[model samples]
Target: MVKNQPCIEIFEIFTAKRLHWVVKDKGESWTGQYFRDIILTERVFPFLKNEENVIDPDEVIFINDKAPCMRAY
Candidate 1:
């Protein structure tokens, strides 16, 4: 029953005012490096920079639930 299934992964980033997402390329794995490079550096940072008001990085807070792939060594 799995033969016709399409392979895709959805990644999302949300703020109080904005939401951003990307669909993974076929066969790409959701590794920690991928999260940092594609999700954080590519999508999230660009979105923050385009907002009308300036946002200080030091004042921002990030909360995570300790997902295995998201932990930093």
Candidate 2:
């Protein structure tokens, strides 16, 4: 892994697969984070395109890990 770059652990990736979403055990391992209801991947392109520029749903990893919800345009 390169310095400062994020690396997804093998275990997290596997668990995320089973859950059908991206999983993140951030801050506390016991309490896991789930994202997108489904796995975070290229398929989420539509959702990302309509959303804010800074936050990308496809890039999102954890459930609780999120930015502003319900953008008012």
lDDT of 1 by residue, 1-73 (tens): 7786877678766666667677886776789898779766776666655544225543454544564433111
For all candidates in order, the CA lDDT equals 0.61, 0.34
Q: How close is candidate 1 to the true structure, as a TM-score?
A: 0.58
lDDT of model 2 at residue 48? 39
Off by over 4 Å in 1: 1-4, 52-58, 67-73
By lDDT, who's the top model here? Answer: 1
Cα RMSDs of all predictions?
4.6, 12.8
Q: Give the TM-score of each candidate.
A: 0.58, 0.16
Clashing residue pairs in candidate 1 (N, C-alpha, C atoms within 3 angstroms): none
Report the number of the highest-TM-score candidate. 1
